[model samples]
Target: MDNILMKNEKFLEKQRTYTYTGYNLTIHPHKTPEVYIDFFEFILKEKFFLSTGFRTYHLALHDLNYLDVNNKLTGLYGSLVRYENLLPSQFIDLNTGKTPEDLKLNIASNIKYKPTFFHFIFFPENHKIIFELENERSTISYNVVLQFFKKILDSDKFKVKFTSGEVHTLTSFKRVNSILKNKKLKHIEFLVSRPNPDIFGDLVDETISEYLEDQKAKNMTLTLTAQDGKYLDLNDNTEKLGVAAAENGEVKAVIENSNNRTEEISTKKFPLNHPQIFGKSVTIRNRLLMAAEKLLPKNKISR
Candidate 1:
């Protein structure tokens, strides 16, 4: 694999320089012991989970701007590849009416490896990749999985192209200091869910603060919204938390936290709607949308 990768270094370098308008890549199965380069592409493109199928898997491609709310590109700047497995239960003995424990043992004995969730984020413009794994078994290393996809790219099987004639590469996170000369103010709001919003809000605020400080992003402002609808403004202390009417006519709490007391803050009724909240985590998605909104021009609104 290393030799194959080294042989394609020049080709990979050339491919990385070009901004891709779109991409088409092949995916190999996780259970396969050997890399089956000739596998049908349709198998890789199928949904991760199926009701009647013996195998379950998911495959999707998302825009960078959509995944990373802070990104300001309309073109395809990055891609996220997520793959997970659904348990194999077809081998279970249904006719014999085995007990749950028996079935469990049977399934365990039949299974060769533990299932894992693999997430790969590729920033083609910067030639950067972020890989994450969840519930991974000790039997498999992340590099082994990564190598499978890397091999596909190294083989020149995965192809990409730039849509625009003029190409500009954004500052890569790996080399932020050399590329990012201009300092831009970023306002980010985080909404915490119920079951002790105050504590969670504080933790989120501290996390954002530490992140900004570590990244040397001094121009950013962090805001926290609790489950009760009250917001804590980390920037200007004068702002107060207020009550606002949501689109559904329900009352929602708005910003204002000062000196660890809520009484000193003033209240107001404002109707605001944000349509870009996404992701599985409510807290994270709201934060991303709020951060993106803050980066927008003052005159522009999400609603």
Candidate 2:
């Protein structure tokens, strides 16, 4: 009994009970924790909440039920087709060029139809669905999925287009802002995957303009193997981005990852971007080049 107890009498005197009101809880984002703004609705509902989302650590909160003391919680995980009713229409109407008033551009339109990597954070008290989308670039799909939220939710605010077909600013921006801040938590994966093909290329365009604007954005480099008709006009876009970056002392030189098959780099400038050519994937143009009777110098300047 030498391992016995020495008790402080003060420890026996008090018991504290913690109450988790709908207001008391919040949907903590995966990465950025500093942002803890409460949404208009309470997330804790008595019944089960529903979702069809990419699994992540933050999502555990829903299944676990706010780390309950009694060890009981509720959630509903359904198939992609199952949640059609939950999804908003006009959500993926970017290509249509015609967006409905109630429906925001859908996130699904990007990168073809793949498994969606998003979640719906439920606020039980307010009966609101805090749709949390992960903004990522580590993979092609990550960026594409984020397109949904990015297009609809502006920085720390919901850029809601009104019902009367007229855009209004009646709602308090701050309340919505908190929701955005919490949603934009840390990058889910180690690095955001580059979007595929069309989507991937667009990201290169966005990266220079958005995140790297403040740096010495000189001599930026782009790497990709483009087929003859792949419509690679990044040179023009990069030049524009470079100039803007320069105004802020960023992005000087540019290099394309063309990697050698046919397209050649033609440029000479310190703050220059040279498209480094890479061999393109197997394509009709590539087959013809392979079948050529006489070898044409790649520097033939076809374009």
Candidate with best lDDT: 1
Return the TM-score for candidate 1, rounded to 2 decimals. 0.22
lDDT string for model 2 (1-303, tens) is: 333332443334343211110101112111221122122111222221233244321111222122132421221211111122224442455776654557743454222222333333322221212222221211112222223223323322332221110011111122222211222221111111111111113434346433433453322443333354443333444433322222222221212333523322111112111111212333322222232211111111111
Best by TM-score: 1
TM-score of each: 0.22, 0.19
| Residue 230 shift from truth in candidate 1, angstroms | 68
Worst 10 residues of 1 by lDDT: 240-249
Per-residue CA lDDT of candidate 1, range 1-303, in tens? 998997776445422111111111222112221121212221244312222122443323322333444542211122234334434353455777653343433443223233333333332222223333221222223334334443334332233211111111111211221111112212223221111111123333345335544664432322534344333333322111100001101122322333443322111121121223223333433333343333222211111
Candidate 2 deviates by what RMSD? 24.2
lDDT of 1 at 241: 12
Clashes of 1: 9
Off by over 4 Å in 2: 1-82, 86-144, 155-303
lDDT of the candidates, in the order given: 0.27, 0.24
Model 2 worst lDDT window (10 residues): 162-171
